[model samples]
Target: MIIAAYNAQDTLVRAVNSALGQQVPVEVLIIDDASSDDTPRVAEGLTRLHDNVRLIVSAENGGPSVARNRGLAEAQGEWIAILDADDAFLPGRLQRMTGVARRHEADLVADNLLFFDWQAQAVAGRALRLADDHVQQVGAADFVGQCMTGRSPFDYGQLKPIFRRRFLHARGLRYPPHLRHGEDFAFVLDWLLAGARFMLMGEGLYLFTQRIGSISSDSSGQSRTILNLQAMRDHTLGLLARPRIRADRALAGLLSKRADAIRDQAIWNRAYPHLRARRPGALLMEMLRDRRSWPMLARHLVRRHRARMLAR
Candidate 1:
């Protein structure tokens, strides 16, 4: 299991302990990304206490993508599991997911996540309420469509999946080191486009805590997030442009949806940067850059007008 840490001293121990206490033989690689907090010292102590735990510290903070890529390079395990320093895996997570993957011959497997509140010290609920069925194999086109066309800015693309090391190595799949916020989305998209056998279990085996500084919840990082998503769209276009990809009608449709979603995001960001903006030129440029954006922006304006009428 690879845990990326950056100023995560408060909850790092719990996260590492969860992985260490799993049912399977686990090797913990904790990469401290130049955290100013006591994360380095805490990680060192963990390494000394347990031989399975290895602590590697970066001299400079290079964000989660770089940290995860570093861990991937050093990993010796047959399967790679990603555990955020602020989150945790439930008991039997590794054993259960591995069994499911092997049974379905899946290259990647992910389960639902349960949200926990840090300050309240309570569990909120499951992030995704799946069907009563046991497990389901998700098609690449369907998964990509759900991720790309959703109204949510980032959609549900941040899911952490356990991947077969051989599959990753064969495809040369690694997190884009340039992306800091939307790297997971891009990574998963790559796997989908590469025709990975992806499985989703109905059970929620990962505990995702609602924390202020987490990458997903940080409001201050919205601009960077938007830019990363734009890059993701560009990458998607490049992939879809390939002859093999263009031959797949379903995949091509998914990619088009992704492009449309990114165009909408561009207009939304320009209109409401941190909830308020006075950038007409930026909005105009966005509309001009993408032909689809004109209709999307017009629809947005209609919604706003209706909302104002209701308020009055």
Candidate 2:
């Protein structure tokens, strides 16, 4: 298991322990992304406490993508499991996910996630619904469609799956370092676009904690997230433009829809600064061009009106 941590001192120990506690034999690799907090010290302490744990402190901060790629290069395991420093694996996560991969003959597999809302102190039983007790193979078109429409609980941005190292190495796949946020979404989409035999099980094996101060929580962070998503959408569209990807008409169409969905979101984000400057007319026009954008714009307007009323 590989964990990329940045300023996660409070949760780092628990995350490391969870990885170590897996039912299957596991080695933990903690990559500290030049954190200014006590994360490096905690990681170093973990290395001393367990022989299977190794800590690598990055000299410069390169974000999660760079840190994860660094861990991928040094990983010795056949299957790679990623654990965010703030998130953890439930018991038997490794054993069950690996077993499902072997049984289904799948190259990559992910299960449902359990969400723990730290601020709200609430928890969701499962992130996705189980179709059945059986493992289901996810098609490229279906995966892309779900991601584009939000019709399904499965999200490449959040679902942390176990990957086949050999398959990844064969494809020369690694997280795109240029993306500051939403890197996981692009990585998974890349695999799907490359025709990876992806599998999904209904079991919730990973606990995803949603807390304040995390990368995706605030306004500035969310702006970056949307922008990164836009970049990935553009990247996918570029690939779809090629004859190779375009040959698959079904997949090409799905990719186009996904790209359009992301473009709408990018437009929404771009309108934020203008909206702040009381330039609502242009923003309204942008939202009107895309039907999907109307709902988002309405919500924003509703929230602003509520705040103003409360202030009054």
Candidate 3:
């Protein structure tokens, strides 16, 4: 199990404990990304408390991608699993996922997720609603289609997957360090492009915590979020240019749609602050730079109007 932690002092223990409690034996690797908080100390404590737990402190602060890549390099496990510092694994998650992978002869396997609202201290909803016996084989087009932004608030990118270490090593596949956001989606996309056999299980075995201030739950208007979206868009455009991607018409079309959605989302993020401050000049400038912003702003206005009507 690989956990990339930064400023996760309070929740690190819970995540590590869940990994240790897994039905299948796991070697827990906690990579502390030069956190300013007491996360290193907490990780150290876990290393000393559990024989299977180990800690690695980065020399400099890198995002989750860098930290996870470091863990991947040092991991000795045959099957690799990722556990978010703030989230956890349900009992038997790794055991069950690995069983499915072996049965399907898959290079990568992902199960459904149960969203746990931290403030409410309860399970909110599930990531997928498929029947327990349902298992889907995900292809490149299918994966890209599900990840289109604005089409869904949550996407398949949120699914935590377990990968065969040999497949990753053989393909030299690692998370892109430049992307602090959507790195998981990029990584899985690369795996699929490299001919990975990806399988999805319907059972919700992973606990995804929805808490305020978490990286995944941050507001889209933030400057960092905008930059991340821009990076994802550029990355997707590059993928679309690839000969393999270009040859597959359906996959190319889906990727093009995903890139366009990402571009529009970035434009919306750029214009949202000005719209909120009622700065018509700045908003007009943004719309002029990207005409897509007009329709996006109009959609926001329509939603706000509906919300006001309901309140009245």
Best by TM-score: 3
Q: lDDT: which is higher, 1 or 2?
A: 1
The ten-residue window of minimal lDDT in model 1 covers: 217-226
Residue-level lDDT for 285 in candidate 1: 71
- Write the residue-wise lDDT of candidate 3 on 78-147 in tens digits: 9999998988898899999998988999999999987665655555566676877789899888898899
Candidate with the larger lDDT of 2 and 3: 3
Off by over 4 Å in 3: 211-227, 270-312
TM-score of candidate 2 to 2 decimals: 0.80
Candidate 1's residue-wise lDDT over 127-243, tens digit each? 565853469887767677667532532255767899898999999999988777667877887887788999988788888765322222233211112245567677667778788
Q: Candidate 2: misplaced stretches above 4 Å? A: 149-154, 211-227, 267-292, 297-312
lDDT, residue 241, model 2: 70
Using lDDT as the yardstick, the better of models 1 and 3 is 3
lDDT (Cα atoms) of all candidates against the true structure? 0.75, 0.75, 0.83
**TM-score of each candidate structure, all chains considered together:** 0.78, 0.80, 0.84
* Span of 10 residues, lowest total lDDT, candidate 3: 217-226
